[model samples]
Target: MSASAAGPDWGIFEGRTLSLLHPASMLGMAALSVSTALLGFQWRRQRTIGGEINELKAQLPNLNGAKTVSEALAAAQSAEMVDTSYV
Candidate 1:
């Protein structure tokens, strides 16, 4: 059969679909996907860092001074400030 006589072949794209064709929409979708991926990575990193921090805190010798969570946070903040200032 001649090429012109044959009908257009849609079989190639049968199992696939184009959800976004417009330039703006495609760019927006790409940006959203990248943002979501970065957010997921950051969340995972924060979770890992938080676990490490908790583990380290557990390993430290307990001071009988701070009983409340607020007091502990304040002490940690103060220690961080002094550490940073010395650096």
Candidate 2:
């Protein structure tokens, strides 16, 4: 279509500005998308690990206030019929 009726077709920012901007804008958008995706992946990974840790905490029983490994084992071996807690 001819722009004769539009009068002179003078666009803002003259000489290849729009053309140069297109590629630069596209590159910037690509970088933004990639960084956002990586951030999302990191968040998802942390959430998954956090959930797994929570599940483990829920499933396992607490050590009956024993500070050391030897003490814990000793407590488990003692007190008959206590189900034998592991360290």
Candidate 3:
């Protein structure tokens, strides 16, 4: 049988229909929709952050190598530092 034909009389759902029409139900539905949207936005933001972190991690080796070279040069110039006393 079709859904409409198998169901109880329409009047049986009158109270439920009225309840659905109430403002609180509408507000609840709106809140649920907004919450779902916000959750999706937060998930997208987290994914973007993760992607950026991975990109930065991939660049770390080059950065570390450059820093090592700079430190080595500074260490070689330590004799210049020895001539300048804070005292």
Candidate 4:
């Protein structure tokens, strides 16, 4: 059967499909899907940020146990600065 004749439906998997009968349910499912995708993105981003922080800490031993990326960078730069002194 043609798709339009069967009405609007969502294909969940390769062969399986969810017949969209109620508009409210469809809306709810769509909202849920979007939120879940956004959550996944945030989780991945958090992991990447954490990895970066760990790498920076390993590379710069003078980081002073900084938790965030900005703080780690600042500490690294400051640690590299040479103090000027004249006698």
Which candidate number maximizes TM-score? 2
Candidate 2 C-alpha lDDT tens digits along 1-87: 965646535575444776688899999999999999999999999879988998897986667898876888888888655554662
Model 3 lDDT per residue over 1-87, tens place: 577546556675656666677877889999999999999999999979988999898876443333576786666676457644664
Off by over 4 Å in 2: 1-12, 54-70, 73-87
TM-score for all models, in order of appearance: 0.37, 0.49, 0.43, 0.39
**Residue 29 lDDT in candidate 1:** 92
Q: Can you list the residue pairs that collide in candidate 2?
A: none
Q: Poorest 10 consecutive residues of model 1 by lDDT?
A: 12-21
Residue 41 lDDT, candidate 4, scale 0-100: 100
* Cand. 1 TM to true fold: 0.37
Ranking by lDDT: 2, 1, 4, 3
Which is better, 1 or 3, measured by TM-score?
Answer: 3
Best of the two (2, 3) by lDDT: 2
lDDT by residue (1-87, candidate 1, tens digit) is 577526546554332343233666889999999999999999999879988999999998665589877788889888767555657
